[model samples]
Target: MAASLTLHPDRALPLDREQRAVAREIYGQTAHLPLICMHGHVEAEVLASNTAFADPARLLVTPDHYVTRMLVSQGIAPETLGVRRVDGGPTETDSRAIWKTFCANWKLYRGTPSRYWLEHELVEVFGVDQVPSAESADALYDRISERIAEPGFRPQQLLDTFNIELISTTDPAGSDLAHHAGLARQGLGERVVPTFRPDAVVHLDRPSWRDDVAALAKVSGTGTGDYAGFLDALRERRAAFAAAGGLATDHGHLLADTTPLEPAEAAAIYDQALAGTVTADQAARFAAHMLYVFAGMSCDDGLVMQIHPGVLRDHHAGIAAKHGPDVGFDIPFAAEFTTALRPMLQTYGHDPRFRAILFTLDETVYSRELAPLAGAYPSLRLGAPWWFLDTPGGMQRFRETAVDTAGFYNTSGFVDDTRAFASIPARHDLSRRVDAGFLARLVLEHRLNLDEATETAVDLAYNLPKIAYQRRI
Candidate 1:
C-alpha cells in the first residue's frame, strides 16, 4: 500500500512543547505574507509566455540539480532522469519513463531539503494524497500532468496562486530583455523583473568569453575592442536593467577577492584577454578588478550589488563536459571575506548609494567573517543562506550565527535561488518555519519578548529582503 502523504500543521517547528506553541503562533503571523523573491534563476520567459508546462518530468526532475545530483550520487545516470547531453546524445525521450525513474528512487531523497520541497509541491501545489513510490509513480505523473494542463497551472497564474508579490529573474548581461518588455506591455513589469548578471563577459577564462563579449557589445551598442568601451557597455546594460524594474545585480565568483587593478594594468590585461594571450593569473586578477569597477557603478546607479562567492563551479570535469554547467557539480571551498573584500568595501562601505549582499557556501564564516563584515559596513547586508546552505538546518544555523553580530535587519530575508519555479514557495516556507522555530527559542529563553519576536519574524520573511535589495529604497 502506498503511504498517505500529509503536511503536518506544525512541521519544522520546535520539538519542545512550550517552544512549539510559540513557534506556531510566530509562524501563523507571516505564513500568508506575500513572497518577495529578490534573486532566483527562473527564466523570465516562463512567466511572459504563460504557457502550460510541457510535462511533469521536465518540470519537476530534469532541470532541478538538487534532485538530479542526488540521483547521480546513487549511481543513476543523468540521461535516465531526462537531462540531455551537450553532445546531442540520446537521453530518455519518454517523460513518463523519467518520472518513473525519479519516483522509484524516492528513498534517496530522505532527510534532504529536496524531499521537503518536493513533498510540499506534491501535496500543497498539486494536491497529491499519496507519497511518491514505485507503485504510485504512474498515478502521480498522470495526476500532475492533468493538473499542469489546467489553465490555472500556467506560470503567470501560479505567481498569484503562490502569493508572490514580486519575483526577479537572473538575466544574462547581453540579454535584450524582450520578455521583460513583453511583461511591461501587459502591465506586469514591476511584479516580474530582471537582475543583471555579467559573469560571462567578465570572467575572461570561460571558453566562450570572446563570443559573450561580442554579444554584450552588440546589445549595448558599444565597441569591445578596447577596455574603456567594455566598462561603458556594462554601465549601459545596468541602466537597461534598472529601466526594466531591476533592483539588484547578481555576481557569482569562485572567490570574494575584490582588489582593484590600476587603470593601466587593467587595460593591459583586458588587451591580453582580447588578444587571447592572457594567462590564468591575469584572468583571475581581471575578474577581481571588475568587481571593484562594478561596485563603483552600483554607487552611481543605485542597483544593489549582490555577491555570492566561494562556489567552485563545475567540480566534475566529466559531468560538465557531458551535461553542461549547473548540473550540480558545483562545490564550496573555504571563503575569506574580511581580507578578500577589504578593497571594495573600503571604497564603498560607507557610500550611501552603495549596497552589497554577501553569501557564502562556507558556513564557517557565518559568525567569523560574514557577520562581522556586514555588521560594520553600512553598505553590506548578509544574503540568506545560499545554494547548498539553503536547507532547514542551514537556515537555523545562519540565524544563530549571524544574528548575534549582524542582527536581523543586516541580513536579507530568504531568496529562493531556484531554477525550479514550483519550489519557490516551499523554499520560502521552510525558511519561515525554521526562523519561527529559532525565534520561538529566543522567546522561550526571554531573550526577546513575544512582540519583538513576531516583528522580527515578519522582517525576516518579507520586509528585510525589500530593504536589502533596495526594492523599497
Candidate 2:
C-alpha cells in the first residue's frame, strides 16, 4: 500500500505553543497575498502561448536542477533523469522511467527545500494524494499527466491560480522580446515583464562571447568595432527592455568587483578581447569595469539593479560540457562586498535615482559585510537568502543575522529566483511561514508587539518586493 500524502498545516510554525499561536496569527495576515516574483528564469513564451505542459517527468523532474543534481550526487546519471546531453550522447528517452527513478529516490531529498517545494506542488498544485514511490510512480504520473492536459492547468491559468501579481523573466540582452510583445497583445503584458540580463555579452572569457557579441550587434543595429559603440548598443537594449515593461537589470558575476577603468584602458581591453588575445586577467578586469558601467546606466535609467555575485558557475567542466550550464554544478565562494563594492557604492550609494539589491550565497557575509553595507547605503537593499541558502534554516539565519543591522526596510523581501514555474507559490509560501515564525519569536521576546509584527508580515510578503523592484503595478 502506498503511503498517504499530507501537508501539515503547521509544518513550519514555531514549536512552542505560545509562539506558534503568534506565528499562526502573523501567517494568517500574509498567507494569501499576491506573489511578487521580481526575478526568475521562467521563459515568457510559456505564458505567451498558454500551452499545456508536457508529461510529469518533463514538467517536474527534467527542468529542476535541484532535483537532478541531488540524484546525480547519489550515482544516478542526469541523462537517466531526462536531462538531454549537448554532445548527442545516448540518454534515457522514456519519461516513465525517469519518473520512476525520481520517485524511488525521493527520500534523498529529505530536509531539503527541493523536497518541500515538490511536496507542496504535488499536494496543492497537482492534487496528488499518494506519496511518490517506485510502486506508485506510474499511477501518479498518469494522474498528473491527465490534469496537465486540461485547459485549466495551462501556464497562464496557473499564473492566475498562483496569484502572481507581477513576475519577471530574465532575457538575454540581445533578445527581441517578441514574446513579451505578444503577451501585451494578449493583454497579459502588465502581469509579466522582462529583466535585462547581459552576462553573455559582458563576460568576455566565455567561449561563446564573440558569437554573443555578434548577435548583440545584429539586434542593437550598432557597430562593435569600438567600446563606445558596444556600450551604446547595450544602452539601447536596456531602453528597449524598459519600453517592454522591464523594471530591473540582473548581473550574475563571479565577483562583486565594481572598480572602474579609464575609458581608453577599457577600450584597449575590449579590443584585445575582440581580437582573441585578451588574457584571463584582462577578461576579469573588463567584466568588473562593465559592472561599474552597468550601475551608472541604472542610475541614468531607472531600472533597479540586482547583483548576484560569488557563485562559481559550472563547477564541474565535464558535466557542463556534456549537459550544458545550469545543470546544478554552481557552487558558492566567500564574497567580500565591503571592498569590492566600494567604488560603485562611493559613486552611487547616496544617489536617490539609483537602486541596487545585492544577493550573496555566502552566509558569513550577512552580519559582517552585507548588512553593514546596506545599513550605510541608502541605494542598497539586501536581497533575500538565495540559491543554496533559500532553505528554511538558511532563511532563519538570514533574518537573525541581517535584521539587527539592516532592519526590515533595508531588505528586499522574498524572490523565488526559480525556473520551475509551479514552485513559485510553494517557495513564496515557505518564505511567508518562515518570516512569520521569525516575527513571532520577536514578539515573544518582547522586541515587538503583535500589531507591529502583523503589519511587518504583510510588508515582507507583498509590499517590500513591489517597492524594492520599482514595479509600478
Candidate 3:
C-alpha cells in the first residue's frame, strides 16, 4: 500500500489541535465558492476544441516552465520536457521517455508549492492514492494517462469539475481571437474571455515588433506605417476584441513611465521606428507614448487597463538564448511606480472613464509606490501578488506592506497566471487557502471580526479579481 501524502500547512497557525480546527473551519467556509480567474495564460484552443488531453507528462511536465526549470536543474533536458518553439521544433520526441525522466526527477519538486499542487492533483483529480516517486511513477503515470485520454477528462469537463466560473486568457493586440469567437458561438461565453495585451505592438525593441504591427494594420484594414495610423489601427483592433468580449488590456512594460507625445514628435518617432533606424531612447519614447495612447483608447472603450511593470525579462543571456522566455530566467528589478506611472496617471487617474490596474514584481514599492497611488487615484487599482510573489511568503509580504494603506478593495484578487491546464484549480486553491490563513490571523489577533473575515475571504477568492479587472464582456 502507498503512503498518504502529507500536507505542509503554514506555520502561522498555532500548533495546538483547536487552532488547526479553526484553520480547517476557515478553509471549509471558502472552499466551495465559485472560482474567478481574471488573468492567466491558458490556451483558448484547449477550451475551444474541448479535446481530451494526451497524457500525464504531456499535460503537466512538458508545458509547464515551473516543472521544466526544476527538472532541467536536476540535469533533465528541455527537449525531454517537450517544450515547443516558434520554429516547430523541440529537443525531445519520445513521450514515454520524457515521462520516465520526469518521474526520476520528481524529487526535485520536494517542499515546493509545485509539490503540493501536483500531489493535490494526483490525489484529488486523478484519484491517485499513492505518492508520486520513481518507485510508483509508472503506475501513477499510466493511470493518469488512461484517464486523461477519456472523454470525461476533456478540457470543458475539467473546467466544470474545477468549478471555474470566469477565466481570462491574455491575447496579443494583433490577434484575431478566432478561437475565442468559436468558443462563444459554441455557448461557452462565461467560461472564457480574452484580455487585451499590447506587448507585441508596444514593445518596439522586440525582434518581430514591426511585423506584428504590420499584421495588426492589415487585419484591421488600417495603415500603421505612420503614428496616427498606428493608433487608429490599434483602436480598430481593440474594437474587434471588444465586440468579441475582451474586457481589459494588459501591458508588460520594462518601465511604467508613460508619455503622451505631441502629434509631430510622435510622428517623427514613428517614421524612425518604421525605418528601423530608431535609437534605444527613441524606442522607449515611442513605447511610452503608445501606453498613453492605449489609455486614451481604454477611456472610450471602457476596457480596464492593467500595467505589469518591472520584470527584467530574459535576464540570463545564456539560458534565454537556449531556452527562450518563461523558462524561469526572468528577474525582478527595483521599480519606481509613483514617478513611473505619473505620466499616465496624472493625465488619466482623475477620469472615471479610465481604470488602470497596476501590478509589480517590486515588493518594496507596495507600501511606498503602489499603495499610495492606488489609494489616491480613481483610475488606478492594485493587482494581486503577481508571478514571483504568488507563494505563501510572497503573499504574506504583499499584504503586510500594502494592505494597511491600500486596503483590500484597492487590490484585485488572485489570478493563477499559468499556461498549464491542470494547475489552475491547484493555484486558486492555494490562494484561497493562504488568504484564509491571513484573514484567520486577523480574527485570532482581534484585528477584524470573524464574520467580516469570512466575507472578505470570499471576495478575495471570487469577486475582486473579476470586478477589479472589469471583465463583463
Candidate 4:
C-alpha cells in the first residue's frame, strides 16, 4: 500500500507552545499577501507563450537543478533524468521512465528543503494525494500529465493562481527582449519585467566573450572596436531595459572586488582582451574594474544594483564539459566584502541615487562584514539568504545574525531566486512561516510587542522587496 501524503498547515512553526501560537497568528496576517519576486531565472517566454507544460518529468525534474543534482550525487546519471547533454549525447526520451526514476529516489530528499517545496507543490498545487514511490510512480505521472493537459494548467493561469504581483526575469546584456515585448502586447507586461545581467560581455575569460561583445554592439547600435564605444553601448542597453520596466541590474562574479582603473590602464586591458593577448591576472583586474563601472552606471540610471558574489560556478569540470552551465556544480568560497568593495563604496556609498543590494553564499560574512556595511551605507541593503542558504534554517539564521545591526529596513525581503515556476508559492510560503516563527520568538521573549511583530512580518513578506527593488507597481 502507498503511504498517503499530507502537508500540515503548521509544518514549519516553532515547537514551543507559546511561540507556536504566536507564530500561527503572525503567519495568518501575511500568508495571503501577493508575492513580489524581484529576482529569478524563469524565462519570460515561458509565460508569454502561455503553453501547457509537457509532462511531469519536464515540469518537475529536468529543469530543476536542485532535483537533478541530488539524483546525480546518488550515482544516477543525468541522461536518466532527461537532462540534455551539450555533446548531443543520448538522453532518456520517454517521459514515464524519467518520472519513474525521480519517484523511486523521492526518499533521498528526506529532511531537505527541496522535499518540503516539492511536497507542497504536489499536495497543494496539484492535489496529489498518494506519496510518490516506485509503486505509485506511474499512477502519479498519469494524474499529473492529465492535469497539465487541462486548460487551467497553462503557465499564465498558474501565475495568476499563484497570486504573483510582480516578477523579474534575468536577461543577458545582448538579449532582444522580444518575449518581454510580447507580454506587453498580451497586456501582461507590468506583471513581468526584465533585469539586466551583463556577465557574458563583462567576463573576459569566457570562451564566448568576443561573440557576446559583437552581439551587444549589434543590439545597441554602437561600435565595440574601442573601450569608450563599449561603455556607451552598455549605457544605451541599460536605458533600453529601463524604458521596458526594468528596475534592477544583477552581477554574479567569483569575487566581490570592485576596484576601479584609470582610463589608460582600463583601455589597455580592454585592448589586450579584444586581441586575445590578456593574461589571467589582467582578466581578473578587468572584471573587477567592470564591477566599478556597473555601479557608476546604476547610480546614473537609477537601476538598483544587485551583487551576488562568491559562487565558483561549474565546480565539476567533467559534468560542466558534458552538460553546459547550471548543471548544479556551483560551489561557494570564503568572501570578504569589506575590503573588496571599499573602492566602489567610497565613490558612491553616499550617493542618494545609488542603491546596491549585496548577497553572499558565504554565511560567515553576514554578521561580520555584510551587516556592518549595510548598517552604515545608506545605499547598501543586505539581500536575503540566497542559493544554497535559502532554506528554512538558513533564513532563521539570517534574521538572527543581521537584524540587530542592519534592522528590517536595511535588508531586502525574500526574492524567490528560483528557476522552478511551480515552487514559487511554496518557497515564499516557507519564508513567511520561518519569518513568523522568528518574529513570534521575539514576542514570546518580550522583546517586541504583538503589533510591532505583525507589521514587521508584513514588511518582510511583501513591502520590503518593492522598496528595495524600486518597483513602482
Candidate 5:
C-alpha cells in the first residue's frame, strides 16, 4: 500500500507544548488571510488568457528551476525531464515519463524545503491521497491531469481560490503590457499587475544589450543613440508601467554597487558601449551608475526599488549555452552592501518618497551589515530571505539575526518569488509558520505579549508586503 499523503495541521509549529500552543494561536490569526504576492516571475499572459494548464509536468516541473536544479544535480538529465534545449536537441516529450522520473527521484528532496512545497501542492492544492513514489507516479500524474483540466482550475479562477489579493509579474522595461490591458478588461488589472525590470537594457555587458536598447527606444518612442536618450527611454517606460498599475522596479545586478558617475565619463562609456569598444571595468562602472540613476527615478516617481544582488547567474557555461539562461545553475557569492550602497543611500536614504528593499544571498551580512543598515535608514527595508536562502531554516535564521537590530517592521513581509504558480501558497505558508514560531518564542521570553505577537504576525503575513510595495488594501 502507498503511504497516505497527509499534511499535519501543526507541521511547522514549535516543538515544545507551550510554545506550540502559542504558535498555533498566532498561525490561526493569519493562516487564511489574503496573500499579497508583490514580487514574482509569473507571466501576465498566464492569468490574462485564463487558460487551463497544459499538463502536470509542464506546469510543475519544466518551468521551476528549483526543482530542475536539484534533479540535475542528482544525475538526471534536463532533457529527460522535458526541459527544452536551445539547439533544438531531442528531449522527453512524454509528460508521463517525466512525471515518473520525478517521482522515482522524490527521495532526493528529503529534508528540503522543496519537499514541503511539493507535498503541499499534492495534498492541499490537487487533493492527492497517496504520496508520490515510483509505485504511485502514474496515478498521481493522472489525478493531477484530471484536476487541472477542470474548468475551475483555470489560472484566474485559481487566483480567487488562492485568495491572492494582489500579485506582481516581472516584465521587461520595454514590454507593451498588452496582456495587462487584457487582464484589466477582465476586471483583474488592479489585482494582477506588472513590475519594471530593466536589467537587460541597463547592464552594458550583455551580448544583446544593443538590441535591447533599440527595442526600448522603439517602445518608449525615444531615441537611445546617446546616454541622455537612453535615460529618457527608460523613464518613459517607467511611466508606462506605472500607468498600468506597476508599483516597483526590480534589479538583479551581480553586485550592489551604487556609485554615481561624472556626466562626461558616463557619456563616454555609453559611446564606447554603443561602439562595441567598452572595457570590462568601464562596463561595471556604468552598471553601478545606473543603480544610482534608478534610485533617483524611484524617489521622483514613488515606485519602490528592489535590489537582489550577488548572484553569479548561469554558473556553468555548457548548460547555459545549451539551455539558455534560468535552467537553474545560478550560484550565490558573498556580497558587501554597506560600503557598496553608501553613495546612493547618502543621497536618498532619507528621501520621503524613496523606498528600497534589499535582498542578499550572503547570510553573514544579515546581522553585521544588512540589519544595521536597515535599522538606521528610513528609506531602506530588508527584503525577506530570497532565492537559495528562502528555506525554512533560512527564514528562521533571518528573524533571529535581523529582528534584534532591524526589528519586525524594518523588514518587508514574505514574497513568494516563484515561477511555479502552484507553489505560491506553499511558500507563503512556510514563511507564515516560520514567523509564527519566531514570534511565539518572543512571547514566551516576555519580549512581546500575545496580543502584540498576533497583530505583528498578521502584518508580516499580509500587511507588510502591501505597505512595502505601496499597495492599498
Candidate 6:
C-alpha cells in the first residue's frame, strides 16, 4: 500500500503528476527561506533557557492540542495523553505509555493535516518512515526519545536549523520581560521577542478577573483596584515589552466589537468589575472599552495591534472547568466585524498612524464582512485565516474570497499561528505548497504570469511579514 501511493499537491481540485512535479519544484525553491513568524503563543522562557527538548511526547504532544484533540476524538483519554487538569490532578506518569496511546489511535488522523505533519516529522525530522501505528509505536518513541537527548535538538539549535529570522511570543500584561531581556543579553543573532496580550487583566467578567488585576498591580507597581491605576499599570507593562523588543499587541476577544464609553459610566462599571458585581452585558461593554483603550495606546506606543475574534473559547463547560483554557473546546462562532468595529473603526480606522490586523474564526466573514473592511480601512489589514479556518480548505476559501477585493498586498501573508514547535516547519511547508499549487492553477488558466505568481509566492512566504511587523515595531 505504501509503495502504491503517490504524493499529491495541496489543492481544491487535485492535479496530475506533471502538475504535482511543478508544485514540488516551486515548493523546493522557497522551502528554506528564513521563517517570519509574526504571531504565536510559545513560552519565552523555554527558548531563553535554550534547553534540549525533553522526551518527544512532552515537547510535541502535550503542548499541541491539535494532535491531542484528534487523538481524543478517536476515544483516547486526555489524561492518558498527559493533558493537565485544572484542579492539579495528575495523569499517567509513564511517557512511553502516552506515546503508545497516541500511536494506537494514529489511524484517526489518516487523510487529515495532522497525519501529514506527523508523517513528515517522522521521516524528515526523525528519519523514520514506517507509519506510526500500534505495531511501530515503541520503536518510534525510543528513537525520538534518544534523539531528543541530543545537543542538535535544543530549541535554539532548531531555530537555527529551521532558519527562523524573527519569532514573537505572546505574554500577559503583567509579565516582566526578564527572560526576553536575558535572551537579548546573551546576544542571540535572530530576534525573539514578546507581544503584549492583556486578556487576563482586561476580561473583567472572568471568574478570576480581580485576582488577575491584582497580579498586574503587583508586577507593574500601580494600583489596579481602580480604573485609572489599572490602566497606568498596563501602560507601564507595554513600555517594558517595547524595551525588550516587543513589536505588537495581541487580543483574543469574543467579538471584534469595540467602542468608547463615557468615562463616568466606564469608571462605575470598572468599580463593579473590580468588586465582582458585573453582569453579562456589562462584561461585553467592559471588554469593548478596554479594546478601545488599547487601540489608543497603540497609537501612542507604535505597537502593531492584532485582534483574533469570533471564538467562543472553552465552549465545553466541562473541559473548561477541568482543564482550563485552549483545551480544544474553543469553537468558531458567528461574527459581525464590520458593524462590530464601527465605533473604534470610525475613530481610528482612517488614521495611517494606527495599524490593526484583524483575524476571524468565522469564515463567512471573509468576503462579506472582512474583505470590504480591509479594502476600505487605512488602519486595518486582514490577518491570515486562523484557528478552525487555518486548514487547506480554509486557506483556499480565504484566498478565493479576500484576494479578489483586498488583493494579496492588503493581507498580512501566512502565519502558522501555532504553539507546536515540532510542527512549525511542517505547517509552513503546507502553506507554501498550497500557495504554489494555487499559483500553478492561475498560470494554467492565464489569470497570472509565471513571473508574477513566483514573486507573489515569495512575498507570501517571506517578505510581507518582515515588512509588516517591521514597519510598525
Write down the worst ten-residue block by lDDT for model 5.
464-473
Off by over 4 Å in 1: 471-473
In angstroms, give how far residue 14 of model 5 lies from its true place.
Answer: 1.2
lDDT by residue for model 5 (141-207), tens:
9999999999999999999889999999999988989999999999988999999999998788789
Q: How many collisions between residues are there in candidate 4?
A: 0
lDDT for every model?
0.92, 0.93, 0.80, 0.92, 0.93, 0.81
Cα RMSD for candidates in order: 0.9, 1.1, 2.2, 1.2, 1.2, 2.2
Q: Model 1: per-residue lDDT, tens digit, 1-473?
A: 88999999888888999999999999999999999998888999999999999999999999999999999998999989888899999999999999999999999999999999999999999999998988999999999999999999999999999999999999999999999999999889999999999999999979999999999999999999999999999999999999999999999988888999999999999999999998999999999999999999998889998898888899999999999998988989997889999999888899898999998899999999999988999999999999899898999999989999999989888888999999999999999999999999999999999999999999999998988887424
lDDT of 4 by residue, 147-257 (tens): 889999898888789999999999999998889999989888888989999999988878889999999999999999889999999999999898888999999988999
Q: How accurate is candidate 5 locally (lDDT)?
A: 0.93
Which digits, one per residue and each the tens of the lDDT, describe model 6 over residues 222-297?
9877788888999999998888888889999988779878888888899998777988898898899889988889
C-alpha RMSD between model 4 and the true structure: 1.2
- As a TM-score, model 3 comes out at 0.94
Candidate 1: the clashing residue pairs are none
Give the clash count for each candidate. 0, 0, 2, 0, 0, 0
**Model 4 lDDT on a 0 to 1 scale:** 0.92
Worst 10 residues of 2 by lDDT: 464-473
Residue range 290-352, candidate 2, lDDT tens digits:
999998899888899999999999999999999999898998999889999999998989989
On a 0 to 100 scale, what is the lDDT of residue 279 in model 3? 82
Measured with C-alpha atoms, the lDDT of residue 191 in candidate 6 is: 83
**Stretches of candidate 2 exceeding 4 Å from the true structure:** 471-473
Report clash pairs, candidate 6: none
TM-score of each: 0.99, 0.99, 0.94, 0.99, 0.99, 0.95
Is 2 or 3 the stronger prediction by lDDT? 2
